[model samples]
Target: MLKVQEIRELIKLIDHSSIEEFTFEHDGSKIKMKKNTGTSVSVVKTVGQPVEIPSAEVVHKPVVQEVPVEKAATVNAEVIQEKVEIESVTDLHKITSPMVGTFYESPTPDTDAYVKVGSKVSKDSIVCIVEAMKLFNEIEAEVEGEIVEVLVKNGQLVEFGQPLFLVKPE
Candidate 1:
């Protein structure tokens, strides 16, 4: 496997050079890179696999410096209030998804939700379930608190360590 710095250097070399495409094969590994008309560069890499798949593109956008205008310097009160609310919530505990799966608030469609905003929960309480690979896994609160927010909706795909709920401690 190529190190991060080596890969970055390769990208830099490709970006600075006039070469439109480059291909490399070694041992059981293969790498192909192509520069397109847009800001994205396509890269295909496979290791000992005889499968053809669409190449993944890496987009590099030029950074633009923002010049502040005197009129725009004035802050909106509503924006300040929203920021304050966000700051306050940052201190609250978060219940994150343990795995990548579909989130379910209830065990069945006909049943009541396991948790909702303002619901009190103990560390062992089942706050929700995550369905992964067709297997339903119950998710615990892991903390004693009141549910302040449900970050994901039913049937929504959740990622590992993704925040599923916000809780305010009792």
Candidate 2:
């Protein structure tokens, strides 16, 4: 029979470690814990066979609740708005990277960059190129603006929908 303290400790260990799944068995009893990287944490416990203590035998199991990403984003936005007024500044707009890739400002290594800081750009202007899965994807500005802040450095491994630059609307 597993003690409550042992189960709590195992839960803590699972939470702290990067390992997504863990299982342990002792004296014909088994416990499994799994972490869902995409959304939440789910813990599953089962006894291999007939167990002496029914209270210690957990079947099916319960999932741990986590904050949704959308709600988290809303909270972050509210916090950011409280700290700074984004609308008052007409010259600051976010330019997010459309895909996960290596950011390149020029077509080739020997050539000059397509745009620089303070560069005026249009909605169709190609700001940078993101090389993803061996293909170079030209990243264009979605909104007409002037480049204000370049968020990511060149040759950085950017994730999908990551912020690449901040543009000030012209």
Q: Best candidate per lDDT, number?
A: 1
On residues 79-137, what C-alpha lDDT tens digit does candidate 1 reach at each position? 54554585587668999999989899999999999999999999999999999999999
TM-score of each model, paired residue for residue: 0.52, 0.48
Residue 29 CA error for candidate 1 (Å)? 32
Task: Report the Cα lDDT for residue 59, model 1.
Answer: 33
Q: For model 2, how does the per-residue alpha-carbon lDDT over 53-134 read when each residue is reduced to its tens digit?
A: 5466545433334555445556565655643554466557777878877898899999988888889999999999999999
Model 1 regions more than 4 Å off: 1-87
Q: Score candidate 2 by TM-score against the native.
A: 0.48
lDDT of 1 at 121: 99
* Root-mean-square deviation per candidate: 13.5, 10.5
Clashing pairs in 1: none
User: For model 1, what is the error of residue 135's alpha carbon versus the real structure, in angstroms, after optimal superposition?
Assistant: 0.9
